[model samples]
Target chain A: MPQPEYDVVIIGAGPAGSTTARFTAAAGLRTLLVDKRQELGAPIQCSGAISRHALEDVGIVPDDEFIHEAIYGFAIYDQTGERHVHDYRSLKPDEYGSGPGRKPLGYVVDRRRFDRYLLTQAERAGADTWLKTEGRGYTPTDDGGCTVHLRRYNQDIDVRARLLVGADGLQSQVGKWAGLQTHIKITELAGCLQFIVDRVETEGLLEIVTGHEWAPGGYAWVFPKGHGYAEIGLGVIATMTDKPARWHLDKFMTQSFFRERFADCRILEVQGGGVPLAAPLRTQYADNLILVGDAARHVNPITGGGLHTAVAGGKIAAGFITGHLEDGMPLRDGALRAYQDVWLDALGDKMWKLYGIKTDIFHNMNIRERDEQLYATMADYFSPTSEFKKI
Target chain B: MSKQQPVLFNIGWNACINCGACVAICPQEAGFVSPFDTIAVDRPCDIACLLCEQICPVDTITHVPAPAPATQNGAGVR
Candidate 1:
């Protein structure tokens, strides 16, 4: 029997792959989305916070089923108890919403549900999906296509595709197979760990804590998850400290302020993964292959956030590939250069600037010093006046 | 007495959450032992760059020198 084939084979069913598959499949391309996990979003790795603008840009309405809490502002805390608050409600009506009521700045979601919802959207748009399917490797074929070798249920399956996409998160092997530079340096990688806890009081504000004492080379966060629950987590540069992220988190929780506040809180769940804090990959595509989401290191360097970029990058990939396919154009690096150019103009430019600021502010610092200037710089970067805030 | 030609690391599977940080940054792709048990560093391609060791959040990977190489007689090898 002949092996099944598709116009595009997307490895990973996360937001990036699903969003890309949704667009490509909807555009009448034969698209397939696969994930190694039996379930779409099990063993969640994200903090699940996404900006309202990001969701709007991706055309995904914030449904109540996945939205855990509505965030209106941010409260940034320095090492020495200094607090700075930015409230989105204070934004001019034109800057936020045209409606009578004040709109939320962002939402903290249940990531598992949010991811599942995205995959469901792609499936509804006519993308084929396979669970518990792993992409072991792939080889470029003649006529500018590739054959993806997947393992499902101890069975080997090969599917040929004109285009292959890597949306496989931080541990993506697709980019490696395509010979794209996907390796992250130790200093550029942030090891993150989060705990779901209840009885922690947080209003509508996402609390951000910055200090070498707390997170070393990264930062910590307290995001409300509604119903009096919250996710308190932190990311640390693995090379900056001899200890692991869990140790830093444990020590952070024992701080006098957190100790008293979280004394009665119950630890409900734990999640952890690595986030690439490096600048976006210089090249995100090769011949007949493209990478989206964390696979392309679309994450924010300073904030270690990628949900927004993942969605946006996926959309761009879908548009670029669909337009090329429709034109009967060859899927070569020269043609795919447009994807890189457009993405840089839209989002990558800001990320590049943030990456510079991140390296300057976070590396080789005095961990004990209360650097108010550093905090001010961070505040400015995220402030309404900053160009990065536009993303 | 026996000689050791290669060094291999043993992964503490109990402590591993299979987050794949080791696999992501490994230059030689030496961290993955299998599709199901991907946490083990069973590959002989290890250059001892120690990036995987530093990147592991749980410190579950430990460098354990492989047992001595077999002698000419090969009777002492376990």
Candidate 2:
């Protein structure tokens, strides 16, 4: 096998890896993007609901078919079963629909299609792409580069790179190999189970219901993906007091509340995974290595949305790597620390505050009080005129 | 009742939801829900004000005051 040297070697072809590859390639870096799976975006694990601002920030505009629905606003249901609906259109006429008149909100995306679109974009940007290439391990070199070991078709191949990016998901082997703290406390980890069911008539609205009875420290989401397909799932924090997430998901899916709504639906895919609900790693970089996306624990503490953060982090990682390469600086602790600082400045404090609030509400508040306060806060946050601004 | 210095308790700010239940149920008017949207503990009037702690729905409130030193025989134990 011919040995190849790349300026940047990115693991996992998910959103983060692809985005990193795109940015680095565009910056004239020799980038190699690899994924373990034979296909990209298969066996989905996300609800794929992202804020409108996140998409525009990353410069990704979904085509009509890929966009399931344009969300009007949000409806939050509290533990006491009271619902509060906030329509952005009614509150802000200037931003209520698609185009100039469309609401400046968000869209529910078809995750699989979206991921594929991003990977395609990376390829077009000149990234050397390899599918079904599983990252085995890496050994840091004396000069501050890395020898990335990968397995393709059961054959081990070694590739060298000046920098390594681990965009792997929650259980990231890359993070471990790079000597970063990757273990998530049971309480901070959310075990989620979901099903993509077809033929379910769901409004173009996103629903988030929170309570111990429903999910216990987490929440259930109903995201419509058009064409009668919807991503429905529940996330439960794996705290000492809470049962396993699978049990809660099974109970919710079979319960009367969801059974009636999904009785006639066909199961398109059964997906399950764990998400780390913590602040981004205090140290996301070291010599010749950096982490992004779930590997860096960038998922939102409040909503558990990670796609946007992952993409953003990926772009930052690319920028940092480009600067390092152009300057011929050693990919040492100090060099990579710049990447960590930039990301923390971008979204760190917000995540920490949200984490604190999540713990407080779940542990101390009663159902009634918790519900009321949560609804009020969300209303204020999502309202067009509310001062609670988005980060 | 002799006036005593208020004992301050730092209720986990994260766990508080700004509910006035604790304030309403305090017999000594020692507990007030602050407008900053947090729970405050008044130690002066609270001869161990466990009411707010007990009524807390999430059990996030904890008494962090040190236990009084025990006396051995007729002497005070340090």
Candidate 3:
């Protein structure tokens, strides 16, 4: 029997895969997007904090319905309790530079709604959606395409495509199968646990606390989602420690500081996840394959924000794949290399540089010193009127 | 003519976080942490200057300058 065929078979229907499917299908390519999840957005692991620049980059306009809060700026505190508040709204253009407009820099988003919106967009663009289907593996065909093996609820099937894209999260089996190095160093991985609490009064400011007392080699964040709801979470660098992430989170959440602050709130949902604090992969593509989003390691090392990056990567990948298909070129190493070079040129170099600075800031200082520096620097770093602003 | 001695430095690989800060800021690409459990050092002769140590998160590295030459009598060394 002839194998099932598609112009593109994308794995893991998260932001990356969905965006790629939307763009490629709109370009008139036959696309099939698959995910293992029963629903579009469930089991949320992210803190859902994205930059204002990110939304604009992905062409996503935040409305009152989708956004949780409109954040003006961030407040940083150190181990010794020294606080520094940086208001992005009050900065002067001479001190910072251009692009420091009066708009909110970003907002905390509802992950479920945001993801579902992206998927809906993809569906509207004419891509076949395959929920509850898990990609098992793939074998390269002699005709410069690939035959993907998949299993759905104990039933096996196959799909053939000229190109494959992997947008799965941290534990991406697709990345591993594609022979990309997905090994995360223990210390570079931040084990995080978060809880969304309702009836929590927040001042529309994102709070970040740095110190060993809160989380070693990591920080705790309280992101206000507005309407008396907030997402509170902490992350710790996973070294050789045998303790789970929840243990550290429990230790911090039950402390006098957190208890006193959030005593009146009620827990709505508990989420735990791991984020990779590293630079984007040096080579995100191979023969007949491309990796996007978390699978491509496009996460920000400082804030762990990946939604925007994933969308951007997906758009770039779709453009490349569309061009390749148009030219009737086989998805060979040279063609994929072009895709890698263009994307990296656009985003990878800057991210790598930022990752370097983030590593230096976190690794060289003790908890107390880090907190102090953050408090001292945040004003200048984020203030529109400060010379160091531009992050 | 006097003889020259080579200096050495020991980097504790186990404590590295693979953050790449050292690689980015290092004037000499002497310090690099790979995801594959390998720490690459380009020139050992550059050990006299220990900039990477200052930026290291865990301080797992120690730079050892060359030891003074021994006396001919093998008594107390300089």
**Per model, how much of the real contact set is kept?**
0.54, 0.00, 0.00
Question: What lDDT score is found at residue B56 in candidate 3?
Answer: 43
Instruction: Give the clashing pairs for model 3.
Output: A52-A105, A52-A106, A91-A385, A363-B57
CAPRI category for model 2: incorrect
| lDDT per residue as tens, model 1, A7-125 | 99999999999999999999999999999887766677789989998988988888997899898878888876587878776655545442566678899988888989999999999
lDDT sort, best first: 1, 2, 3
TM-score of 2: 0.77
**lDDT for each residue of candidate 2 in B2-70, tens digit (9 for 90 to 100):** 253234556775644333323322434222434332345443324444444543333445666543445
TM-score of chain A of each: 0.94, 0.91, 0.89
Docking class of 1: medium
Off-target runs (Cα >4 Å) in candidate 3 are A92-103, A240-243, A256-259, A365-367, A373-391, B1-78
> RMSDs, each prediction?
3.1, 14.5, 12.4
TM for every model, in the order presented, reads 0.92, 0.77, 0.76
Two-way TM-score contest, 1 vs 2, winner: 1
Query: Which 10-residue window in model 3 chain A sums to the lowest lDDT?
Result: A92-101
